[model samples]
Structures are given as structure tokens and as C-alpha cells.
Target: MSLGDEHDGQTRTRLPEGNTGDPYATPRRPARGSRSLIAVVGVVALLIAAIALANRGSDTPTGGSDTTGGAGAPARSAAPTAASGVRPVTGKNGEIPTGYARDEQGAQSAATNYAVALGSVDMFQRGPREAIVRAIHDPAVTDGLVKRLDDSYSAAFLANVGLTPEGLAPSGLTFVSRTIPVGAKVKDFTNDTATVEVWCTGLVGLAGEGSTKPVTSTWFTITEKLRWTGGDWKITGSEQTEGPTPVNGDNRASMADDIAKAVEGYGGFTYAR
Candidate 1:
């Protein structure tokens, strides 16, 4: 979702006059035609050559032997897939995850987890939203940020997105909003401060029979400036931009009921690396 549309205090892009529609349901086109067989073969050859050249000088030893039956070439560094075994937080702050480490990797992990919290549907409500803000944000800025967010999630915005004035989905309808981090990078780092950018994709909207705002997905990047405070990382401020989005695939859209069922069955994750 656009930060201006539903998440943050930035100025929003106004729809054209009288253009009241579900903005998330933008039309999609079929993917472009594929390359010819010969073209594809040539491209694959080039890619193989490039990979071989790139890894030619790597020093890490590989498990397999070379075609000439000599010691194998070096292997590339493995990508991170699990937690670093850093001690985890012992508890939650009103359902917000906490107790992050006080280092660069810890900062990246904190930013990723915090992005999930901030982009969650829970942020649409008052009490959980406040708890989330207090848990993830720096104490120095929490009060002011809470007020800013309260103003941003105005009643008009809530009503526009099919929420009650109190930010609840009407009975029988489930509002789905979740952020899944694809990856995170430390832009800058220091003992007491860091800036991290987390690339994420999300689902948002209302789901139920006869619902107009069927859930839709969005891609965005959240950049957070953080500080080591209270023995862990806390967000000092943050901003979001459209995406590092890729071309859309030709997947068929699911029915609202199926989408709702899938969301309920598939739980979210606690991101760490």
C-alpha cells in the first residue's frame, strides 16, 4: 500500500474528481510474449559464462571436484536463512516482539520485525496500535509519533477503506493487513545508531461475502533510522517508498472467500537473520 494511502503522515495523492473506486484493484495485463528458443539459449549461455567468471576467483573451497578431477573451485558465501542464534527476547511488550541485540545484525533484525508490526492490521485499532508504537519506537519520539499516527488514520480515511469510525471491520468481515519482509540491508551502522532498509510485500483490505474491498497485495521498501535505546534497537523515524517491484505474473485472482480462508490458515512469521 502507498504510505500516503493508509500508513503514514505524508501528503496523499488525491484521486481525480468523482473517481471513487477501490484503488487497490488496478487492472492487470497478461505478461508479454516470450523470447524465441535460439534467443533463450544464447542468453542462458551468457549467464553461465558470467557466473563461471564471477566465481573463478572465490577462495572458499567447494565440496565437489573439478571436471579435470582436481580440487574443486571455491564456493560463494551462503545466504542467511535462519536466526544468528543471538539470544532472543524473553517476552513481548503487549504482543510486540522485543529484546533485540545491540549490534548491526540485531538492528537489521529489529527493523524487519518492526516493519511487520507497523504494517499489520493491528495498527488500524487504537489500543494495539498504541502498544505497537510504544514497543518499537524510541521513547523520545513515541508520544509525538502516536499523535501523528492518530491524525493520519483519520475517521474519513477509515470509512473510505470500509472500517468503522473506531477502526473495526464490520461484523463478519475480516480485515487482512500483513507485511512479509523479502530482505533487509544495513545502509549505515554504528555502535549506537543504524539505518536499515527492509524490502517487503503486503496484503491489505477487507475480506468476506459481498465485500467490495477484496484483499490486494503491494510491494514497498521501508527505511528505518534506529537507535540503541533501553538495551535494544528502537525506531527513531521511518519512511516508505513505492517498491523495487518486479513485473507482475499471470496468476489468476482468487475469490474473496478463498483469500479469506488462506489468510486465516496461514500465520505470519517473526523475521530474523
Candidate 2:
């Protein structure tokens, strides 16, 4: 699904703040016997799943980076030019693929990346979100999203996460919701329409101390049915479903101090395809 999140500063988060708190969690107790056996099975499953996804990505011809520059020009690009935001860093959607997104794979990639961008932490900001929605979504969907997003960030909603009418935390809290598109493919494509599923694994939670909303993660598949309009793909209708996801690994959770440090030290990415 096109999951969304925000920082402590903005009031434009996708869902009401209440829905974000204690987000979509379930118990995960290791199976009774044969812990090592279970671990082995899980690791193997993850490896298999990763291989499959990598194959899909490799099969799909994606957008390429075209850099025309004088020496030391910083590439004239604000975002990284990769299909999956180059591994860790920050993982979310970037500006709509400008060129090279012409064919079916390109269309699918553009749609997937657009979805990830639309459902990103930047949407919590006013100027960026409006610009993004206007640029990516068909005109019809834009108005609805604007109005609905306004409501979703209403005073009542913001109150859930201890925000004021302006959707701001008391002092030091940071809201966090970011989606990382693992891979995407178009099940079907046509001149004027396409059905693409962007399988995304993402992190969602609050940053900063004493924040009610803790950072969490989720796996979902955002199936977007798009219509080609104005020379680009736009979402006509979309829905999310349970992921074709693998189980989480047994790595120890990062310490809270580390989490805070990472949040401050690291930066977000610009996704492409």
C-alpha cells in the first residue's frame, strides 16, 4: 500500500494522528521448538524472496541517469538516480521521472515511484505536497486529495499525537513515515491504461524523545491502476493489500540512542526508475 508519514513539524500526514499511534502491530513470538531450525528456514525464505525480487527488477528495463555537466557541478539533480534509492540512506519517492519513462516498464516504474513519493514524509509539508500532487495525480484526483488531506490533519487528528492546530509537536518531537519501494512491476499495460503493483517495505514511526508515536515498519503492496493522461501515468484508482512479504529477521533492535543518532546523522533519498 502507499503508506505515508510525516515529521513533527507538519500537519499534512496522510491519516489522522490517532491512526498513526501504535500503528498496525502484531505479536511475534518465536515458534516453540527448534529455534535454530526456524531461524534457518526464515533466512532461507528471505534469501529466496530477495533473489526473486532482484530477478524481477533486473528483468524490468528502468530509467537511466543522463548527466550533462561541467566538472564538479553536483550533478544538477536533487535526488539520487536509482531504482531503489541506493539501499539504506533515505528511501522514498522522488520527483516524477521526467524522461525515459515512455514504454510499459518505464510507465510502471514511474507509477511506482510516483506512489512512493506521494506517500512520503514530504507530504507533511504544505508547498511540496501540493506541488507533488498537482504534478503526478490526474487533475480530478488532486482536488479530492487536497480537501481530504486537510481533514485528515484536522485539529482532532493532530491532537492524537500531541500537536496543535498547526500540527506541530511541543518542542523536540519528530514525526516519521517513509516508504521504500523494494521493486515494482506492471502486470498489465496498455497505451492508455496500466496496472502496476509496487511492492514496498517501509519504516513508520515517530522520532525524538517523549514522542507518543514510536517508529515502526510495515510491508505492503500498492496496486495502482493508472490512466495515461497528459503524457504521463496518473492514478485513477488504487488500493493496498497484505504484502507478499517475508518474515522479519532476528537482528537485535537498534538502541534508542542509536535510533536518534541515525535519524539526525542520516539523510533521505530520492528514488528513481
Judging by lDDT against the true structure, name the best candidate.
1
Q: What is every candidate's alpha-carbon RMSD to the true fold?
A: 17.3, 15.2
TM-scores of the candidates are 0.72, 0.61
> Considering every candidate listed, which one attains the maximal TM-score?
1
Worst lDDT 10-window in candidate 2:
3-12
Model 1 Cα lDDT, one tens digit per residue, 101-196: 666556766887787777666766777768877888788988877776676567865776677878788888877766767777788988799998
Stretches of candidate 2 exceeding 4 Å from the true structure: 1-97, 162-164, 270-273
Cα lDDT of model 2 by residue, 1-273, tens digit = 111110011111111211111101111222334222111110111111111222222223323344577776553332223323211112122343433243454455565556555555455445665676666666777777666555444565455434455645456765454556666666787767878776776554445766544555657676777777876667666655547778889988764446656655555433333
TM-score of model 2 (CA atoms):
0.61
Shift in Å, residue 53, candidate 1:
47
